[model samples]
Target chain A: MKIKLVFVSLVSFVAIAFLIYQWWPSPERAIKNRLGGLAKTLSVPANDGDLGRVTRVAELRHYFAQDVRVRAGASGPEITSRDALLGLIGAWTPPPGGWTIEFVDVQVTLGQQATSARVYLTAKVSGHDARTSEPTLDAREANFSMAKQDGDWVVTSVEAAETLQRPGSQD
Target chain B: MKRLLFGSNARLSLLRAAVLVVTAVVVFGYVLLPVRLQGISMLPTYRDGMLNFANRAALWWREPARGDVVAIRMAGPRVLYVKRIVGLPRERVEIAMGVVIVDSVPLIEPTVVYKAPWNLPAFTLGDDEYLVIGDNRVMAMENHDFGRATRDRIVGKMLF
Candidate 1:
């Protein structure tokens, strides 16, 4: 009877473990760690030296997920693969003074091996001048979707809009 | 005194079962759900927020069609994007100003709002690339978008 009890317990344990893997990714902690590391790499101070950071971020684009679509303020959308992200960084007008992720939220569905994240951005773009009310501050909120494929995770889509707390803050 | 309603043996077994069930649901849902979202970007036709199914295993069996919406991966670890197939391998496509011309002939695609000029540049798709475009142009990418999309990036076609 003792042997039977142990066998039953072992079988039940294995089954439960499998269920957790299907339901939620405890392994995704690795992905979280990588994300924090990547953020540090992409981050650059927005100062007179901001140009270098912008350039580095542009170069980093090549390493970014290829299936990026930038919906340019309701004008046209760009389906950026590696070349567009890496080579055409100069053409892109990312929010001025360079932007950074102020906050990030993630929700994971284990069965699909997918994660949905909402990242809030704080961008400081160039406006008129200090004499003219110190130029406007720009901020954007973007929603991103990432999925696992063949043992890797890549960004799939992003929807971004400027979020403002006051009058005319959103640009 | 509180009754010993649950024996240690029975309670332990029950707790184990609950954890197992939760894990399974998470794994299965994650893979299936987002993979579906990737290929279902055919808006208006497929809508934006609905969930679609992706049989990531399709590329091994057959090739994509002219209008098949597909999810593709980028060079990075796991980036995926979706778009509709516009041209085939080695076909000439031009979107000048806002007009689309293929080999000196206008495509007159039903979905496009503005056509691109055909004289932008001529680059035939390599065996690995699959030329694509969104339902609405004018927002085309920087590259002479008439280029190739690597075969490996092709995730899967969309399903309602």
Candidate 2:
């Protein structure tokens, strides 16, 4: 009887363990998917007042409880929600120049507060410029922070890394 | 024979440990975790990081009443937001500056607050929309889309 009881309990335990392990990470993934989808809506080319929405979007990250920080490769003024839109305005006046950029990899960690995501990607630039005669290539790793307001997710800030100079190209 | 008995016991113990860990994670990850994660934002009554219960089942028994605080899901596909219920669906909501008058009666705002800049009108709310604004109007609270939190998105009310 004693041996039979032990065997029964062990089998039951294994069954329970298998069930929980399979569904455990769902809520976290749900939150991430929600935040990411909302972010995609705001990822259009920065335009007039669009930056304000971006600021509010950035503020969403704070709900996840992380601070926002940003690092950029191009030598330009820091982009704010308003600035992002204004930058486009400035870019469009004479259409200064256009560049192609994509985040290589972005990992967003969703939690109560202090939410942060790391983004990796490359940018291809090609246009008439006083800076960089040819198409300059730059890669970066950026960390984004998320937060909450009322009861929604916001991107409070971002921190991006600076890329080093090419092997032989330092004038 | 002795080795067989010991080996089986050890395997059983390992299985038990695995079960305990998994059970803890489910209870912690789903039910307990969301409760603790839900919190009061920017209000003195509910301090920052204070965990609050959500009464989603309440809606099943009765219609959501006026002045009850609710956790609403915003339009951003996957966003979960909380706010005080100021207007019922289809009720005409009017706002001037930061104050709200629903059916011409002043609705009591939540202890935690915000006001959107854009005058949140009844039209802005698509059929299932609920107009909820924060009490603190400092952060462009008086003019923004945060007010038009939809009803279908509401998870439940905040349990104080």
Candidate 3:
């Protein structure tokens, strides 16, 4: 009876430990949380004041690395530095209905060293057309390369993943 | 009522419930991926907010044939595009006045209800490449998401 009790305790302890490990904050989870925060920050409210807009855009710098590279589209121009990206973001204007940005289907692959990760996700943006005032929803796949910097995951590079290539275009 | 709900033994009933849940997760998550249509890209045939299933095992026996409405996976499977296959592998595909031409032959598309006068230069698809486009041609060619997708990107065929 004593032996059976010990065996049951051992199994229960192991099962609890395994569950805890699975629930613990992992690198992938950290990166996903960071990306989620980034999405929330990127979303704009229609009634946002000028101060809120500037503050939100300024907060974007914390999510990116200093030497971050951003490519909005396959053919779009690349932004080399975080400052440049923030500058463009500050100058951006949202429609009357504002913009909602969400990152879904986020898949994170950790690097061999565990200090770096590559995230593949679909960026869904919903807003109103500036000219027509019609609601528009656009989704595109994007890749984000991030590294652990000062105990935070900071995006180092971002590129839009174009699943289909344009006709007659040579890349 | 209690016996009918929990069977003769509680442990056996719990085991059966677990098995049913596992089987459902495997079947729906992998075999038949449930997808909700989002945009007007595939108008007329599949409207917005329509629920459909993509059979991941549909192309197991044969390659994807032309005119098959397939799910085009983006980076991962979380989000995908539903498009109709037009140009097969190694075929030259071009859009002249919104009519798709394959190898200098005007392809007949029955699902396309509206056609925009869109012109695209002819381009030859590489090996294992298939051209995919939405059914709605009313939208401008530049605004629509249609182009050459690789074989690996074609996840599965749509099951209406």
Candidate 4:
């Protein structure tokens, strides 16, 4: 009876330990969850008027630090400052046919210090221009550096990593 | 007399199970990892839906050489990309008309399946930095995403 009790106890302990490891909240999961929400917020259609769009853009600014440095494309100049980044977005005219944006393949890695994270993701934007009504399709790969500020993750910097060709499109 | 801790049959079975588990962990964890290709940027070398093995053991002792196909570690393992390393550290790379110019010399890339007019100004690479590009260069300069990948970004060599 004593040996049987020890055996049962060992099995129960192993099972409980496994359950804890599986359900524990990890740093990678935390970063991924934050970035996932950010992606959804960024992909929201900005077809509303400049004022409405600006409000949406303002929602984006809250995800970033006050002094955020952003480079939109590989050849684009780096804009430093939250206002400047928003200004660049505000300058854009909404598409006449509406726009569809998607962020996919999001991968996040926590920094060694545990206070920073690096994210790599792909963004696809397709729509028609408001002025000329020309169809526009843009796909890009970007890397974002995020920092933890007061228990909230905020974007510190963004770099345009690569420009991907739309799949199945002939070069 | 020799006696097994467990019965002879059970001991042999447990030994076989342990060996199998160890082999699987070593092979899948560090030696060879399977990945699915997502895009046609690699073209004739790797198809869009083909399965390939990432040879992590390739870079264990040595750095990757130019023209070697490699997988890069992006934000995480799930978003890694496969590309060929072209420019090594300290080398200036420029694309003129469809050819790659390295330090004023034309770089010989035999695996390039297509060549499109890609004009990029010369940029010197920093230490521990590498220029990675796809084999399908026929894609327009604007469409293809080729850029610098630092040492830590590279995950391992790709085996087709």
Candidate 5:
């Protein structure tokens, strides 16, 4: 009877341990959470003035590596230097009133060595143009290559992958 | 009455449940894996949102034959593609006038829906490579991401 009780107890303990292990959060999940937070932070506008632009650039720079290359649109040339990329972003003047951007459907895939990852996300930007107050809706997918530095994931490059929907191809 | 709470019947029941759980894990994880279709690439045959099973045990016993629908792993095991195998290892494949040519012989694909023109140059597969393509050939060739599926990349054959 005592031997049977010990065997049952051992099995129960093992099953519970296995369940816990399955439910535990992994490194991949942690990296995904970081990327999501960064994407959300990027959507916020900082085109109020020079200070606002500076703050925005700083916040954006925090999520990127020292040597980052950014390619805005599908046919846009690659911005090799990080400073040049920031300057290009700073040059953009916000539409008269303001704008809002949201990132959705974020998917992150860790590389074979876990030192790098590719993040696929959809960005929706909506606002009115300064010249024309017509509200505009633009959606695009951004594929980001991230590298791990000092134990923190940082964006190394960004490429506009594809449009969420083809133009006039609703069918 | 206290011993009755943990009697032979209760122990047997617990053992049965454990056996059932183990069997399910082994069968689903290693033998019969479930996959869900995501795009119109395999339209008319395996539509989007359809669910099916891939038999891994079949591949273990025999080589994957031509015209067999297979699941290929992409971006790791989480993302997979369901495509029909048209070219075997070390075979030359080409797409001409919406027809698939293997070793200079045009294949008779009854289920193929050709709405777009395709004129791709012939390419030879590697020793352990197999060419795969979707049944919906109507889509533009540039949009379709079909090519050689290595031996290790093919997960298994579709059950149905």
Candidate 6:
């Protein structure tokens, strides 16, 4: 009877330890949390003040590395440095109704060293057209390369993965 | 009444409940993956905001044939695109004035109600690639999403 009780206690302890290990914060989870914060920061509110807009744009620079590469779309211009990206973001004006950005179906694959990760996700932007006030939703798949920098994940590169190929384009 | 609700014995009742839970998990999580339609890409055949299931076991026996509507997974299974297979593997596909040409032959599509003057040069699909497109050809080619998808990216065929 005593042996059976000890075995049961051992099994319970092991199960609890396993559960805790599974629930502990991991690198993948950290990257996902950072991406979520980025999406939240990218969303623009219609009633935002000029100061808030400037502050948010400045905050966006922290999400990327100093030499981040950004390719907006298949044929869009590429920004080679974080400063260039910040310049574009600061100059862009939101629509009349503002817009909300979300990242869905995020799948993060850690590199062999675990210091870097590759994330594939769908970037969804929902807003209203300035001309017609009609609601518009644009979703596209994007790939992000990130690395651990100063104890936080920072995006190093971004590339849009187009689902459809354009005419006369060989890819 | 209690015996009828559960089983004759406690052990049997526990076993029955466990079996039921396992079956539910297997059937729903693996066999029939629930999908919610979002866009107007499949306007005529499947409207927006429709709930459907993609049978993951549909292609277990044979490869996907032409006209089979499938769910193409992007990045992950959480969001997928519903499109019909038009060009088979290793076949040349083109869209000239919105008419799909497969291997220089114009393929007949009874589902497309409206046709636009969409043009795309002929391109051959790879061995493991399948070309998919929506039934709503009325939309501009530039606006629509249609192209070659690898075999592994296809999640499953739609089960109505």
Work out the TM-score per prediction: 0.43, 0.40, 0.87, 0.61, 0.63, 0.84
Compose the digit string of candidate 3's lDDT tens values, residues B1-160: 9999998986678678979998999989998889888889899999887899989999888899999999988867767889999999889888889899999999999999989999988889989899999999998888999988999988899987
Per-residue lDDT for B107 in model 4?
89
lDDT of 3: 0.89
Estimate how well candidate 5 is docked, as a DockQ score.
0.04
Candidate 3 at residue A40, lDDT?
95
Model 5 chain B: which ten-residue window has the lowest total lDDT? B72-81
Q: Which residue segments of model 1 deviate by more than 4 Å?
A: A1-35, A38-171, B1-50, B75-78, B96-99, B102-105, B113-119, B140-147
lDDT of 2 by residue, B67-91 (tens): 6766653222122344556666777
Identify the candidate with maximal TM-score. Answer: 3
lDDT (Cα, tens digit) per residue for candidate 6, span A1-171: 686587579869999999988778999889988999999999998866778689988899889999999998877899999999888888887775889998998999999999999999988888877886767677788999999999889999999997654435664
Model no. 6, DockQ: 0.51
Tens-place lDDT per residue, model 2, A1-171, is 787788789889988999887667653444455555644443333232545444655544433333233335334355455345333433442213434344333454546543433322222222333364343332334455555455555555555532222111221
Ranking by TM-score: 3, 6, 5, 4, 1, 2
RMSD, one per candidate, in order: 14.9, 18.4, 3.7, 8.7, 9.3, 4.0
DockQ of each: 0.02, 0.01, 0.66, 0.10, 0.04, 0.51
**By the DockQ metric, which is better: model 2 or model 3?**
3
Better of 1 and 3 by DockQ: 3
Rank by DockQ, highest first.
3, 6, 4, 5, 1, 2
Identify the runs in model 4 with alpha carbons over 4 angstroms from their true place: A1-14, A25-171, B1-11
Point out the worst 10-residue segment of candidate 5 chain A by lDDT.
Answer: A162-171
Q: lDDT tens digits, residues A1-171, model 3?
A: 686587579869999999998789889888888999999999998867789789998889899999999998877999999999999888877666789999998999999999999999999898877887767778889999999999999999999978788777762
Candidate 1 per-residue lDDT over residues B1-160, each given as its tens digit? 1224434675566677767887766644433325423222244455443566554555557888677777654322133455677666666665556655666676666755443343345445555556666553434334322234666657677554
Per-residue alpha-carbon lDDT of candidate 5 for residues B25-62, written as tens digits (9 for 90 to 100): 99988788888776677878997668998888879978
What Cα-based lDDT does every candidate model obtain?
0.50, 0.48, 0.89, 0.76, 0.75, 0.86
lDDT of 6 by residue, B19-89 (tens): 89989999878888898886778879998768999888998888888999999887777678899999999
DockQ of candidate model 1: 0.02
List, residue by residue over A73-102, the lDDT tens digit for candidate 5.
766788887788778777877665667776
| TM-scores for chain B, listed for all candidates | 0.59, 0.59, 0.94, 0.90, 0.91, 0.91
